[model samples]
Target: MFENLKILRRAVKAVATKDPELRVQRFYLIQEPQVEFLDRSTHYMNVGFWDGDATTLDTAGEALARKLGEAAELRAGDTVLDAGFGYGDQDFLWLREREVGRITGLNITPHHVEAARARAEAEGVTDRLDFQLGSALSTSFEPESFDRVVALESAFHFHPRSAFFREAYRVLRPGGVLAVADIIPIDGATPRMAFKAGPLSFLKFSLPDENWHDGSTYAKELTEAGFADVTVESIREKVYEPWRQYMAGRVDDDEYRRKLGKALHKGVVRHWSGQDVMRQELDLLDYVIAVARKPE
Candidate 1:
C-alpha cells in the first residue's frame, strides 16, 4: 500500500537523522496521519490505567488522569503547573472534572502547545489555560507560584529527571504537591536488556542521555529537592498488563494497521511494539505513580 511505502521511507529518513529533537518531532508527527483513529478528545499518549473498571480507551485514560489527580490531592481552587502537558488532554480533564482554577502548561513541543492553546480557546477555557513552549528543567514562572505540579507519564523523557524535580520544587508553593506518573527502569536493569527490547525501546524511549532511573533513585532525588513525605508506588500490573492487552487486541485491526504504518514511517515503531517488549521482559521496567509535598 502507498501508506506503508511512505512510512517505510519516513523510517529510513528518521534513522538517518542524528538530532534528538528532530527524532522526537518525527515521532509525534506519526500521529498527524493517524489522528482519525485516535481518541481525539483525550489525545492520550501514555499507558492507560486499566483497573478492571475501564472497558474503553477513553475511560482507561481518564482513570490514569484521575489517579494522578488524586495522588496530587488536587483542590478545586488550586493553580497547577502541568509539565509536559501532552496536547492538554489531562489538563482538560482536570479543568472539567476537578474544577481546578487555572493551569499553566509547559511543553517542549511547539505544535502540541499550539493545539492545546487552540483547544482551550475552543472550549472557552482559554482564560484558565496557558500553554507555553518550554522545558520542565527551565521555566520563566516565579518561585512558589503554583499549588500543584504534575507530569503525567512524561517525566521519563526529561534528561536527568532529577533536574525537573528541583525545578518543580522551586515553582511549587509551600505545602504544594508534586505528582508524576512515570516509567522507571526496574532496579538493576541494564543497557543489554534495553538493547534487546529493540530500537524503539532503546533509541527512542530509553535514550542513554535521558538517564532513566529506578523508583528509589526518583524518591531520593525528590527528597533532595526538598520534598517531604515522598512516596513512589509501583503500579505496573494495573498499568502495563491491561494497556498491553488493549493495544495488542487492536494490533490486527484495520485502523490500527493504518496507524502502525504511520508509526513505522516515522521510525517510531521498531522491531518490537511496546506491548510485545513489555510482555516478554516485564522485569526490565516498572510504571510508577510518585507523590511528594513541599513543607508548609
Candidate 2:
C-alpha cells in the first residue's frame, strides 16, 4: 500500500514536470528498476518487426535491426554512427552479426549512455564501441567521419528532424548511408486524428517538436540535405499493429499489469497505457524506415 502511494506520487510529479528534458529524465528513472525484470539481453525500445507467430520480442527487435542494416548496406570494417541509440541493443547485435568495425553511439540521455557503455564493456566490445552523451540534431563529430549513420526509432524525438538529416550528411563520408526507423503522422491523416490522439500522447512521445512530418517530407528533407536515392517506406501494418498487439498482450498479463501499475505511480511507465488508445482508436501515425546515400 505504501509502495503504491509512492508510485502514485511519482506519476503525478512526472505529469507536472513541464520541461521536456527533465520529464524524459524522470520517465527513464522510473523505467530503470523495471529493466532487471525485462529481457536484459536485448533491451530494445523500438517497435519490433513481427513476421508471424514465430516472432518473439527479441527476434522481432533483431529483425528490425537487420532491416536497418540492410538499408544501410552495413559491412565489416565500416565505422557507424548510431544516433539516439537506446541502451545500445542494436549496436551489440550489429557487432555480433554484421561484424562492424566500430560504432559511436550518441544519445541525449546520460544514464542510457552509461548503461550502454557498461554493457559494451561486459560483452568485451568496449574497444569497438564508444557511447557519448549528446543530441542528434547537433553533434561534435568531424565531417565525413562515419561510413554509415542510423537511428532506430529515435529520430521522431529529434525536434525538426531535418536538422539531423543535414548533420548526418555532414558527418557521413561520401557514399555513406543514412538509415532510420521512425514514426510519423500517417499520410493524409486529418487534424481530427491528431486531436483525438490527445496531448498526453504527444507529450509522452515527444512528437510535437518533431513537426509530425510524413514519409514524403522526410524523403524530401534527406534529398535537400544532399542525400541521393532517398527512399521512405511505410511499414505501419508490419510494425505498429504487431507492436500494439504485443504490448496489449503484455499489459493484459496480471503480473505485468501489477508491475506496470507500480511503475506508473512512480512515473517510470508514463504514457504506455495511452499507447493502446492511440493504436486502437486514433490511427493517426505510421512507422517508416528510410534510407539514403551521400554521393561520392
Candidate 3:
C-alpha cells in the first residue's frame, strides 16, 4: 500500500503536468502506455537472446529457469506451473523437452496469455501447455496441485511479497518446489538507484513509483511465508554483459529488428531520459532469484 500510495502521488503530479481535464487510470500502478511498451520490448528482445532453449523457454521471459531447473534437479514428467507465465517460454521449454507432464501457466495480463497460447499452438505443444489470466498473488488452483511452481522475474509486481509466496505455497504440493527471480533492494528500501534506473526498469518491475529491496529481503519474506530451505542465488554477473550485448544486438538481421529497436530506443529515452537504463547493471545482476519449497 505504501508503494501504491507513492504511485498515486506521481500520477497526480502527471495529471497536473497535463491539462488536468483527463484522469489517468492511475489506479493500481498502471504505467503510461509508452513506459510499459519500452520495458516489455527490451525484456522480450534481451531475454529471447539469452534463452538458448527458447522452444520451451521464451526469449521474452526471464532466463534463469534453465539454470534453476538444473540446480533443483528438475526434469521431464513433473507437473509444472508457471505462476506468471509471460510468453510461456519456461513452460514451453518444459513442454518441448517433455520435462514436465503438463504445465499450467497463469498471467495477470491478457496480452501475455494470448501470445502464449498462440505460441503453444504454433509449436504443436498445445496439448501440454495451458495459460489463463490471474494474479500471481491470488491465483486459483487447488492445494497441492503441482510438483514445481515458478515465477520468473515477475514477482516484484506482487506487493507485500509475502502474499505472493503464501499463494504459491497454497497451491504447491508438499515438497513441491517454488522458484522466483526478481529485483530487490540491497541497501534498505531506497528509491535512488530505482529513480536513476528510471521508469523503464521501474515500470517493468511494476515498482511503486520507485522502490527497491535487497535480495536478502525477499529471501526472508519467502521464509516467513512458509517456504523452507530458501536460497538466493545472484546470477547478475553472468547476465549483465550477456544481457547488454544482447540488448545491443536486438536490431538488424531479424524481422522487426529495425522497428522494434527504433521503438525501444525512443521508449527508453521517453521513460528514463536515456536509452540505456540497463547499462549500469552490466556488472552485477540487476536482480536475483529466490528458490524455496513447501515441506513434505
Q: Best lDDT goes to which candidate?
A: 1
lDDT of 1 by residue, 1-296 (tens): 46546655756665566765566555565435244335335677777798878866778888999999999998898999999888879999899889999999998878889989999889899889999888888888899999999999777767668889999999999999999998777863555334454423433443435445678887888999999999999988887667666655665567656645664433434343665555766556788999999999
* Candidates, ranked, lDDT: 1, 2, 3
User: Model 2 misses residue 254 by how many Å?
Assistant: 4.8
Question: Model 2, range 1-296, lDDT digits (tens) per residue?
Answer: 45556655755665577765555555555434464335334678776888764265777888898888888888999999999898898998898889999999998788899989998888888889999998878888999999999999887767667889999999999999999998777753445224443323443435445556667877888899999999999877787677666654664567655655664433333334566575654366777889999999
Better of 1 and 3 by lDDT: 1
Taking the tens digit of each residue's C-alpha lDDT, what string does model 3 give over 246-266?
Answer: 444543225434444554444
- Where model 1 places Cα greater than 4 Å from the true spot, the runs are 8-22, 33-36, 39-41, 192-210, 254-278
lDDT of 1 at 276: 56
lDDT of 1: 0.77
TM-score of 2: 0.84
Rank by TM-score (best first): 1, 2, 3
Model 1: how far is 76 from its true place, Å? 0.8
